[model samples]
Target: MATLFVITLIATAIGSISGLVSGGYDGLFLGASTGLVAGVAAWAVALMVAQWRRERRLNRYFSQDGPVAQHVRQNQRS
Candidate 1:
């Protein structure tokens, strides 16, 4: 969440500055809006990827061939 905010702020600042330099007031608004959308999209994609990776890791950890499963099997044999 914090990272998302930071990314949005940086993108908006960059867009606003560029727009101000190229097209004045109107450009600033357009650039800021575009930047905001892009930032949010980027953040969403990043979040999804992070979630997917975490789920994959957790699945692996709990799978039959995983360390936890092996430990349980060894304990049962004893």
Candidate 2:
């Protein structure tokens, strides 16, 4: 989390600086804001992707014969 914050700050600084040089005052502010928003958005997206991957892995493993499945099956018979 600390690393992410540092990286985000560094990226924001670079974006803002580049914006100031390439564009104008408005660009600097907007670029910094945009960098922060984009960084958080990307993190959110990555989290969702990781969660989906974990769910997929779980589903795949569950589809195989295992103790959990066996227990479930045994319960269903009772």
Candidate 3:
């Protein structure tokens, strides 16, 4: 999350610089704003994907034949 935010900031700055070079004041502001929005959206998507993968990994550990579950059963018998 933090990494993504940092990336977004960097992207926004780059966009602003590019716009300034290519056009002028109007381009600079517009590019910066557009970059910011795009960055945030990208961050959100990354966060969601990370969360989904984590959930999937956790669920695997909880499955009947998973190592964690097998360990639990052995401990119970002991």
Candidate 4:
């Protein structure tokens, strides 16, 4: 998935940078493992946040005070 790829890229970049700063390939491997965990965590959080926002928007759209509800009320009056 695109989400996974983006997260992995970012994680890899951070891991590689940290690894290079600390030493050689050993650091790189450690950083990479850390990055993988971080990326998956980030992706999960992102998914949760997105779903929450979408549900909220849908609820609002159908609520009595929402635009669609107001439009229906106005049409009924006419």
What is each predicted model's overall lDDT from 0 to 1?
Answer: 0.90, 0.79, 0.90, 0.87
Mark the 10 consecutive residues where model 2 has the least summed lDDT: 1-10
lDDT of 1 by residue, 1-78 (tens): 898889988888888888888899999998888888888888899899999999999999999999999999999999
60 Cα displacement, candidate 4 (Å) = 1.4
Off by over 4 Å in 2: 1-7, 71-78
Error of 3 at 56 (Å): 0.8
| Model 2 pairs in collision | none
Please list all clashing residue pairs in model 4, or write none if there are none: none
Report the lDDT tens digits of candidate 3 across residue range 1-78: 689989899879988988888879999998898888888888889999999999999999899999989999999999
Candidate with the greatest TM-score versus the true structure: 1
Q: Model 4: per-residue lDDT, tens digit, 14-57? A: 99789878978889888888887888888888888989999999
Q: Rank the candidates by TM-score, best first.
A: 1, 3, 4, 2
lDDT of 2 by residue, 1-78 (tens): 566566678778877887888789999998888777777776677678979999988887787486678889999999
Model 4 lDDT-worst window of ten: 1-10
Candidate RMSDs in order: 1.7, 3.0, 1.8, 3.1
The per-residue C-alpha lDDT of model 2 at residue 19 equals: 80
